[model samples]
Target: MPQSNTPVRDRLEEILARLDARRDRERAYVKLYTESARAEADAADRRRQGGATLGPLDGKVVSIKDLFDVAGEPTLAGSIIRRNAPPATKDALVVKRLRDAGAVILGKTHMTEFAFTAVGLNPHYPVPGNATDENLIPGGSSSGAGVSAVEDTCDIAIGSDTGGSIRIPAALNGIVGFKPTASRIPLDGAFPLSPSLDSVGPLARTVTDCMLADAVMAGDPMASVVARPIAGLRIGVPQGRLLNDLAPEIAKAFADSLDRLARAGARIIDCRIDDLMERLWGATRIGSIAGLEASRIHADWLSDDAALADERVKGPLRRRLAVPDEAVAALLETRRALAVEMDERLSPYDLLALPTTPIAAVPIASVETDANEYDRVEGLLLRNCQVANQFDLTAITLPMPGQTRPAGLMLMGRNGADRMVMEAALSLEALLRNS
Candidate 1:
């Protein structure tokens, strides 16, 4: 198993000390469970010292996204009006699973309001700076979870992905994030963004950490990821709109990574999926499936306290509130059709590979100050990875090799193939790291 070698108590203290530093406020933790976390760490350490049987996640420090229920506290889902919402009666399902596996729960991290935005700007809380560059935006809406994973605040960060929230931030922050098929991990205690599109997953510095948390959360019993051989692996590279408007750094790193894979004996095939994407996008023209679903989730709130939330979140969602019921029905039908088509389209290949984001993280000020920039960056950030959510596929994002600026190479597979994607990522991650 790939559990951390450091003592759990020491690791917890190190993270707590770092979080306590005033300058780290931009690191974006919304709340800290210091007392309970310390108790858990002590328990884990005692278990370790006693030569107890340990799960893969035993003694690992894990952070929860603010949207998950933690018992006795209302899940904010990055919204303000929920301050007085009734507290949850129990931990979220995934939270309970992680604890059962002996993970040390850290605390909840910040997020975009209602998990709506791609750029990690939460006007309601402290925004997390990019892990590598303070000036760059940490991708969202799993903003703080992403930061916690890369910044070593936690060994694993539990987050939700709807329309690329997990992969976008993982790519920008240069960590590994896995989005299992939406149904793989139960979502009962998570605050909904778009229930149809939402999947809870993990972000961490290594694919192993993500794989461990994923299995635990899904009630799977796997202890380690066996790296699949790169030789003869069929890797499909989708060509067209998903690859459009790439920043030079992203483009070069992607090209370089492909060269490495090809040289390592993987078969690289150029696949065309632009028409499929256009159809998917065309179907949701009234409002994105996420936007439409979110409209319904926030229906009551929009009628009463919409003005209290960030305009970026409430404005777009409010527009979707009036979408005719028929349009929503049609959209769901189209989503099912697209998922079937995508499943067939991906059948021939073991996996699909692409740059996770068209561009690297941009200056926080640029997106924060300009609505135009925010719109453009949000669309681009969500462009490639949203295909996975729309089609119900599984995916993982690993940092591209040898880049001064971080970029991610995302690998995606058909629905219900979460473990297949992880096995491939195990080998691919090794290949990328060596390069």
Candidate 2:
């Protein structure tokens, strides 16, 4: 809902200045495209001054997660092992699209090594602490993406969501994060985490920015997305363990949001897909869709004793590499069936709603000191949002209204229902803000 009239060059300089002033900027960005960014910003400024702006994204300050390729640079993907890897021959497809649309690239932000972890800790890089609090976890593997999305230096931070990489950080940082249908945005040239689950999305302070970035990256014709009317809107709240173990604040915030929507004449129905979810989980018991595919993607390194690689990433992937080939086949077959069933179940509603994370950001010290504590925290954070990735649905996370610490209210739609999900989120964002 907020707009800035500052020139793109000025904005870029201010961000660059702030980076120069701060010693901890490595926590947010692994690289900064200083010269090229300035050039682009100046061009954007010239266009604005001449009334020939490219489109909504023109002149917008944007940041990409480290997994994406820039011409002639190896995408480190938040790990040191790749420093010796050959530089990319060309820009990643999404990067090319963003650049073509006139977005000023601010360089690559930090992420979990290989985007394997969900709670933001990467032994390989400096922690990009939570935006609101220094001690709390920033949420991973798009940890920097989350922090950058909230920081004024970046207007939109692009991140990949295999299993909540985008939404988790966005929720923790209290920004809007959109994860579209898996095939909605092309993934060429981006480092692979899980080919089956990987998706590219944008995190911003407003739904409109997310919609705009998504459109450009998706190569859809530029168009405006109006907020759908809440009156008679059908929102389905999944009734099950997804709503369990609410941090008192998260529970109250979710309940209050549902109440507000109901008061606004939106019909909130209790939707059940517990069986479908359980079956999906059961099938993946051989291995998760991500870990299994990632093992193959990183097979070359899995055999090496690379000390710099985060075991958190390599360890699980190593284990998944051992899963029987037949099991992998069965998992994929079952997943396809369940995805179709889940779609039918959710067809009656405009969107499926729930808390993005079961808990808000937790103390980094606690998670870092204890292995058990880290696993517990990561599971809870990834639990709610992973459903969308696993079940072939698209989702968005909006900052929960009136929360002391940041949290998110997620609305998921049937797979390929990206526009519907964005529209509902736009309307819901307004309702929550006004209330």
Candidate 3:
């Protein structure tokens, strides 16, 4: 919501200066599109001088997650194995849309290897540090995308969400992230983790920025989001295991957020969404959709040389290969049925609110050294966000107020209700800011 009268190129230079200053400590970008970005900024300035502008994001710096294609660059996707992969002949559809909107392409940000893990740990590349605490893990696979926005390297970060990649990093880094309904954004040219669940979205400082970026990426008309009256909004709080485990700080922060909403006239109702949760758990039981899809994509590469991948990823990849075909079929059927059930369940409420993650960001050292701890933390981090992905709902994570550790209050709406979700998020964000 902050506006600057400075020239686009000038502001970009200032951001570049800051990026250079912290280059040694932060690994937010795997590639820097300096020349192209400067050229784009100059063009934006020319457009402004001619009294013609692209839109709200014209001349804004935006970073892409490595999974998305950029012409002339190999999409490494945070993996050394893909270092020798062929360069993309053209930009991904979303990337092309960003360019068409007059956004300055900052560069491709780092991510988890093939976006396999929730905890952003890349043995091949320097792991991007947490925006809030360097000692903590930056939630990933879209690790650098979140850090790029938090660090002011870009105005917004374009990222993908399969199972909380965008929201987890946003929650951990204390930023805003939006995952629209899967069908809202085209996925052509993006490296897939799960064709069934992948959705392209943005991470930024405010819900407005995300709304603008989402519109641009989807090729939809830019529309203003008027915050709905909070007093009349019906918000459902799922009363189940989703709310069970919480770090003291996170639990307190979430409770206080709900209390603030209630005081502002929002009707907060405790509801049971057991059927929705059960379907999600069942669909993901045999092998993750992402893991299965990733296995198929990487079959030849893994077969040739397993040593190319990190040990942590190799184990999961192998397990995905062993899943029974019958199990996958059953899970897919359950997923289809549950998607409908979830929509019906959520139709009564404006939104469903939950803690973005059960715990705060874990120390990078803890997860890196202990595999068991990594598994436990990964599950906890992905649990709440993955529900939206499985049920095909649009979701957004808003940073919670008064938290010593970063925590996110997530708002989820019915599938294809992305605009509604964003408007509600704007209202909630305003309430939190005032409180």
Candidate 4:
């Protein structure tokens, strides 16, 4: 394994120090489980000092989503509904993988309730402020995961993306966020919101960090992705409606990104995706499979105290229950058809590129309380990302260079094309930086 000159303790301590500085009223973590984290890090350093080194992530700290099972820690899933649920009997599969790789578990990060809403707003717990601007909403469900990664609270922050939860926050917060093909990373012990679309991935400072985290979560040995130039890449962009709603700043950044890639010898093709809105609706319609499953898991709690749940959360969940069986079946069929079409359309190129979100981060306070605005902004926030989940594709959102407000350039690929997607992403990363 490659070794670093920096001491493990010093590196881990630097990340933890940033976490300490973030202590405040609007912090996301309700209970950090800091004692357990410190113990794990200390043990890792001691093992290293004793000349018994382990995996590549020997002392790296990763933040777990509140939804994952951490031995002896309650799996809140970002709601009070399961507050009384018993402590997890064991760490979830991903957690086990992290442990096996010698990564220190740095406690839980807050998220949208039941991981449903894209906007990162939870009335019950403090919302983590977007790193770039305190006033901006950390595009979420996986809100804190992105913030923690960007703020250096952890080397990697794990999150589940159903409809852009992972990519959204990463875009707003200015970091690399990846949503692998749903089955690429196991979700055995994580809470489910949309079974069909739900996928576990990470938000990190660099694509290299995401690569490392991806390997650990998948129970594979760590490996490095040698950065390649963007020369000869066939980059596709869906024109018309998909690119219509972007803000002026996002449009400029995207155009600049294209110019850089083209200069690097990439062929930028204007691709058109028909029935995109229908596909988006179908994906969202089928998304209720999770709510149905989750509702079953929380049936007792919902019946016993539905009123105690966050009102905003109840709206999304209740809507799922109201969806007719026939409608769901129809949506499932639509999903199958769309998936087939996506594969045919995307197979010709190595990857497709677009603006990650139609707009940049919205004001945090407004997102927290205004349901109508939240729905609109959240839809816009997730528009581009939903396409990947809709067709079961893998995608990465890289923060484009330049621009103070923060925006992302999305690179997408067919389902199960994770390695190819990563290769394209690393190439684009270099192109954007050197441009």
Candidate 5:
């Protein structure tokens, strides 16, 4: 059992002080469980004094995305529409797991309404500003989770990534985000963006922190993860669509990361998987499983005459309703076939690396004012990460080294190969930090 010299109550008080100082400016938390967290920390302190600790995360404060149920609270999913919804009778399975492991719940964080867009602008709640620059948009859906982690308000922030939500915010905020295979963690009470793609994961300061949170969520024993050496590791870089149209800063950071890995004796291969890319893109264009499922989830709410939901969410759902059943069936088939082909193509390599986002964080004012720019930037941000979700793969975004603006180097692996991706990320993280 690992122990911290700092008392849990003391740590919680320190975090509360920081939260108090920044609350008006950051707007990171939607609901602060200050009273409950204090109680938990005092309990942890008693256990510590008795020489008994819960686990690795005992006394650690963590934030949950508003998408998850928290017993008596109405799971907001960052929407005013859900304000009248009934309270959850029990904790979400993931929340219960975290509590059982001795993690203090620090309250829910804000997100894009229904986790709809890649750009994290909430018309209802105050949108959390980017951790690096207040002017920039904090990457979507998991916006507050990333902000909270980056701001040191919590040890970990649990968020759901359906289409780059977790990784996007993490990248823009210069922290580590991991999206595990959908099945690795149960989604019993998580509000769905796309049941097919929604995955519960963590955004944290280090790869090891993510691994610990992931283990607790997955109901697995926390195990020491040894980093796989970068030497002799086969890493592939997709050449065509993924690498196209990279912003100068993003390109430079990505290229520099590749150079470091190559110098470390890793085999960096230029892979051309245009057919798979085409298939994936086709499915996205035709109709998303996310959009289809979202339509179904909100059908009753959308049916009301009053404008209850945001247009950004309503517009997509309305479009999804027009999509024929045949089109959805065809898209599912295409998605399945492409997943198989993509796995086979990537089997030879330990991981595939790409620029997490083609562009860096855009100014919040720019996107909020210009709808066209918002659409273009949102599509680009979700482009690379969408492939991993559609292909049912595990992926991670690691912050690149020595850049004025934060950029991320993404490593994606096969569906069940989460540990492999984490190990590789650990090694890569070391390289980035040392460089």
Candidate 6:
């Protein structure tokens, strides 16, 4: 198929064109389930020419992470275990919404098996190119979603964020990723990884793209707010322990970003939230509730189809077996307490800033084969962002393109205050561009 001549499609169409080209070059898709997608896109084009339009995203091509159901396609989720799983009889809620809004479903993108890991290395399928660097890890479990967007194959790539699955890949691949309040988006028809932590969002080229995807996924109307200036905005930067553990390149880029934001008139404040490390450690020790829920959700498959599971995915899946009942209870209590704690802390500021990930993309080869290396990648990948998920807060990662290794300036807000966080993010995005 030739690229669209209509410039109105912008980011969405450009990506679909590139995706088509790359599929021929790198052989990325396992199913390439797009027979319906082409028909949908053509229908959208006819609507446009006939003076009918859905919204700003009308007629754009979108790629769903394989974990999501697309009516007739199987939800592979980059696993061999469900290779013979029956096709979905209906589209996932988010998928149906996109179709209603004029988005052409561009089939499913690949990911880590059952989305167990942060690095996007799937043994069951070929690894998609990381766009910036061919050899580096794409940052998973949303690996191909980010790949599809970064390579311009899809304007918006939907992904579920469970411990940084969406943001990690987006950060590594230089795209915008939003991890919204956990319960905001419906997880009705998607495959479960850690249900408690799995909030689906998108990886896109710009903040606008992320916002558009977020609206559709949350089933909210798309509304645009003018980018509020960052001048006099209270933005806190935590130091001491939380910011102490970072790679030199990441630290330098973070420091530079702060200086730039401050110069652009943001009220950059130095502060430390009490029990920062202790709270995070407690959350981990409590055995991620999502992990346990994932196990429960997939109990039948895990028991009957255990042998067919990917070896790399099994290690993380096993950890769920060890989540003590008492620990799960304790974690739930801590989540409530921590929410109160964070609310008190963030009450004084518009947003808290942090580096999305401490290091850039690691090599794909090492991350795929060695379990220890996989752990390292997971740790660094989810370190900063997962904190927001644990507390049920909202956060966004804004790309910092000038850095040697691509990094993101993260903005975090209190639970249920996603709108405020996104407003601050949009302001910060403008501040970053000017600076």
The global C-alpha lDDT for each of the candidates, from Candidate 1 onward, is 0.89, 0.91, 0.89, 0.80, 0.89, 0.77
Instruction: Summing lDDT over every window of 10 consecutive residues in candidate 4, give the lowest-scoring window.
Output: 297-306
* Candidate with the larger TM-score of 3 and 4: 3
What are the RMSD figures for all models against the true structure? 1.6, 1.2, 1.5, 2.6, 1.7, 2.9
Q: Candidate 3 — what's its lDDT? A: 0.89
TM-score of each: 0.97, 0.98, 0.97, 0.92, 0.97, 0.91
lDDT string, candidate 5, 19-99, tens digits:
888678657898999999999999888998999988878888899999999888788898999888899989999999999
Q: For residues 3-57, what per-residue lDDT tens digits would candidate 3 score against the true structure?
A: 5466888988887888788778658898888888999999998998898988988
- 330-379, model 1: which lDDT tens digit per residue? 89998898889989988999999999999999899998889998999998
Task: Tell me the deviation in Å of residue 173 in model 2.
Answer: 0.7
Model 6, 119-172: lDDT tens digits are: 777776778768788788788888888887877677788988888888888888
Worst window of 10 by summed lDDT in candidate 2: 1-10
Question: Which candidate leads the pack in TM-score?
Answer: 2
- Per-residue alpha-carbon lDDT of candidate 2 for residues 104-217, written as tens digits (9 for 90 to 100): 999899899999999999997778899999789999989998998797769999999988999999999999999999999999999999888999999999999999999999
Q: Residue 332 in candidate 4 has what lDDT?
A: 63
Candidate 6 local lDDT, residue 399:
87
